[model samples]
Target: MDDVTRFLAEQQYVELTTFRRSGAGVPTPVWVAPDGDDLLVVTVDGTGKTKRLAHTDRVELRPCSVRGEVAPEAPRYAGRARVERDAASVARVKRAIGAKYGWWYRALTVVEPVLERLPGRRPRAAVVITDVVPLDS
Candidate 1:
């Protein structure tokens, strides 16, 4: 990761803005962590955000303050996110995010263990790794 990518990954949270099927905007708060040279974001498969990403890989991710307020006119980073479905990668990514964020992510882990041996209650999907190329590229 370059300076810009590294800096963006270090932020507490990122605004993941995707386009709705109706050509409207749908933004959500995403927990992201750096994966060597890419950004990894976690989400379920049946979500609207996932469907939107399938239609258009293009997305805007902006680093926000800890208080969750972004500067009114701050510059946002532009990139495309390719959804990944690898088990190992997803586990590693989740751990990284939890470690960096500390408490909140840890809570999620407590609620849902990565390796669940339950018979009928398994997670359908893990996480989506978004390999980002700067907009200027």
Candidate 2:
């Protein structure tokens, strides 16, 4: 496996940093799964990172703690991200995530729909990131 895929496979959470119009980086912790040569992340559709990615595909990924804390010595990978809205693509990503995360993934599937029905809850979407390049390269 390539470095990016290997790193992601060993990590439970990754810090996905998306750029804002002002060139600021917003980092969020997300569950990630290997998808062929790419990585997939499922997140709320209308989140800032999702909106920012729409304008700019440039993104950075690094193994991180569940709370978004980055390990100082971890390598960072760069890639272009695209949101996936189609049902088939979304289902594919969902299955990948579920397989990787197991019970936690199952629990989320059970709880997310109820959470979405609550006031102020946002719908979820999947993002596929391609052309990942290690920053050291």
Candidate 3:
């Protein structure tokens, strides 16, 4: 595995910063899994990050706490992200995330169907980030 993949795989959460139209950084904590040399993150289809990603593929990732606090010594990784809306692709990403996250992931899968039925609760989708480059800290 490359340095970026290896470094990220050890962390439980990543601060995924997507850009707004005005070039503002909006960072959110997300669960991530290694997909070959790339990274996969699952998020609600209607989230701001998802919408932002549609207009821009640029993204930055770094190790962070579960609440989105950036680690002081973590290196930033730059990459291009694309949404995966296909069922098969999303399922594949979900499996990888579930395997990495274990019981918590499994529990979420159990509740997701019910959660999706609520008003304004859109289905979840996966974002695949590739061509990751570690930026100098």
Q: Which should have the higher lDDT, number 1 or number 3?
A: 3
Model 3 spans with C-alpha error above 4 angstroms: none
> Best lDDT goes to which candidate?
3
Flag regions of model 2 displaced more than 4 Å.
Answer: 114-121
lDDT of each: 0.69, 0.86, 0.88
Error of 1 at 12 (Å): 0.4
- 112: Cα error in model 3, Å: 1.6
Local lDDT at 80 for model 1: 74
Indicate the worst ten consecutive residues by lDDT in candidate 3: 1-10
Task: Put down candidate 2 lDDT per residue, 26-49, tens digits, no spaces.
Answer: 999999998777788888788898
lDDT of 2: 0.86
Q: After superposition, how far is residue 39 of candidate 1 from its true place, in Å?
A: 0.8
- Which tens-of-lDDT digit does each residue in 41-76 have in candidate 1? 776556777778778877787776654567776557
Candidate number with greatest TM-score? 3
Q: Per-candidate TM vs. native? A: 0.77, 0.90, 0.92
Ranked by lDDT, top first: 3, 2, 1
User: Candidate 1 at residue 7, lDDT?
Assistant: 72
